[model samples]
Target chain A: MEKAGWDGFEIGAMLRTFDGAIQNIATTLPEDRAYSQSSSFTASVADWRIEKPLFNKDYCIDCQFCWVFCPDMSIISRDKKMIGIDFDHCKGCGICVEVCPTNPKSLLMFPEQKDEESALVEWPKKVKKEKEDEVGEE
Target chain B: MSEIKKIKNLKEFSTSADRFEGANLLCPGCAHSIIVREVLNATNDDLILAASTGCLEVCTAVYPYTSWDASWIHIGFENGSTAVAGAEAMYKALKTKGRLKQPDRVPKFVAFGGDGATYDIGFQWISGCFERGHNMMYVCLDNEVYANTGGQRSSSTPIGASATTTPAGSVSYGEKKNKKDMVAIMAAHGAPYVAQVAPNKWKDMVAKIQKGFAAEGPVFINAMSACTTEWKFAPEDTIAISDLATDSLVFPLYEIINGTELNITYRPKNIIPVRDYLGAQGRFKHLFKKEYSYLIDEWQTRVDAKWEQLQRREEARV
Candidate 1:
């Protein structure tokens, strides 16, 4: 099941385990009230994106510089190989691009405005379609 | 020692081994991330972190999501030192009561706070903690203001710098008072270890963190962290600004041991003018304006005087 308000990182599942463990303490103790709330606070940093990284798998060295120096931890690494970036969380610091030792630079960043505009236009259409489907079912 | 040898070469420092968890939500160019990574890498032992309410705490430990691999506790803005002290006490108590059966188990305690919490709000608490001699490390990631509170002026704010509360206008020229000398205050409290460092020179900062962990009593490291958002600088200029601050002696890397010994860690070959540092950031841009240009000279004089004072103190210690 999708965790509401989270950016869909696999760590969200891990956090749920902690939420489960603290469920009793969270409910019983007033001091644990803060911990009781869902750990699903959206970092909401996607709006700050001015540039987004375009990763090229062909020239990648898998050194994980993008994963390492990223202030937002936007890059995802799996099995010792950096696979991709979580665009929703990436604040477009471009430290990854700066630190990448590759001569041609495997990771590149371009203006985020195009993606943002398309995404914004696509959202309401999807919502309207979903609404029409629900009305037809009724 | 192995860790020390590994970090000696910045290229060999692996991101995989870093204790700070990934996907942290700090501002893109925030220097605190580097500080956290370096400080955590200082000690090889299991760790416990106590963070006060600030940018690091709010952004890194956002309820369910945490950017730390170690056990972390948040006890509000002014309680970083006291909370860590309590945790240190609990660790000792557990060991004494045989609850922690491991014969060689020693977990290092680290407490973190911003300048707002450390310099002004938690001053008494931190002073008390230092006096009590807790076996913990306190790090003030001083960006020189209450940055987490939307760039408000704090006691740590430098003179002639604009902040939300100290905005430049017809009546006032940014912040009027000089930046508070929190390191001297900490040193006076007889802290076993007190050092001012910047992560721009990661090796120097890592060395201080190592020394801080090895110290017997309360140790404090004041790290100059550049905030790209609040300081009104380009994201890529974080490192550059930090280097400028160090190069200009605005944030000198120095240590005070046993409250008497003073050692300047890394001195620039030639001191750069304060304007190089100030003019690089937007906060101090107004100081260079024709009307307020005198403030630049005044600010430089203050920095030079402070640097001279440090030199005298270092010489006197010998």
Candidate 2:
């Protein structure tokens, strides 16, 4: 999900180079990603989501392959508890689908469709019975 | 060398906030992004990243947009380390003078650049950093060529792999010279820690990074990153191709401590020929032809020789 709501943080002091020398050498504030870009700016490029992972939690033994291989880190893991993919930020790299080592893959990439049924919007609520009938049937 | 913080499993590794928290515009299957993630995950403390002007810098930080969650600075094409060295110097000075607010938890300084910058353009700065004994880690995400700048051949590009500048149409057989032995060169600098890691090998990669972080003096990690677009490989093959690279011994996993103690991290059970790794990528597709069979042999000979040399070094350490 795009974590929206501008928290108007001040842009920190920036290092500027002039004539090959760094200027404005000061103890600057650490950057708050909110100032410039939503750390979840990947959500803005939603069109980049060509494909989305269909997670079969039933088959997921929580091997954590999907979590580790995800370049975007869109796969959320809380306190060592592996959770579902955050589709908003997932650029549909399908790396999770490819790296899924399960027999009946816990994660499989499907073409992202506009329909809410096939889309990951309902991923958390989409039951195992329904997923088996649709994706796991193959 | 610091005690290698072993990641018990993948679950433990995934718990951290993704270092490159901002959305990056790196190509879909770029291994450089994965390498960046691993580097970020290597430490949990605050980080100050200094990046050179390459794929990582341009794609991640496009004015008013940034993919980095950590404090990052990009100087010039040839001064990733120089910038980081200055930052680290200032941090230490302020901390020593009790001027820094957070003296207890000073940030770790890391400099990252592609092979073009590391093996070529920024070599002088990197050498000076090592000689000057800067308290920083320099990571070279070596994807062979200058992929960001239209796939130009760099010193790290392997022989017989076609690149934009070194086209392999009729007479040319891609890059002419061997990939620069950067690991050895860094070790020669008397670095406290010098390692060569394949991004796909997560366990070894994480350990090497932790060790590099722990080292008291300068550290260097030459991480072999795969380029899906430039290499013309399927996005799915990113991990598999790098796995093949290590298995074939084209890319070995090892660490050099204090420039003398050598440890070969992973030796494949069966050393597959380099053809398996080469045949999978389009850049080396020309070398698969029957006429180019000799090229494969030449490549294999070099890889095997290097493996033997590495093995000898590891054995000598005992």
> All candidates' TM-scores?
0.79, 0.87
lDDT values, one for every candidate: 0.75, 0.78
Model 1 regions more than 4 Å off: A1-48, A54-69, A74-89, A96-108, A112-138, B1-6
Chain B TM-score, candidates in order:
0.96, 0.97
Which candidate number has the best DockQ?
2
Candidate 2 lDDT by residue in tens digits, A14-123:
52111132121121211222333343344345468777776766667777777666777677777676667676567776777777766567777777874535543434
lDDT of 1 by residue, A24-117 (tens): 2211321233321234223347778788876766567887656545666567665557777778667787767766666456776767865544
Instruction: Give candidate 1's error at residue A72 in angstroms.
Output: 2.9
DockQ of each: 0.10, 0.23
Query: How close is each model in CA RMSD to the real structure?
Result: 11.4, 6.6
lDDT of 1 by residue, B80-137 (tens): 8899899999888888888986547477899999999999999899989988999989
Model 1's alpha-carbon lDDT is 0.75
Residue A86 displacement in candidate 2 (angstroms)? 2.3
- Give model 1's TM-score for chain A to 2 decimal places: 0.56
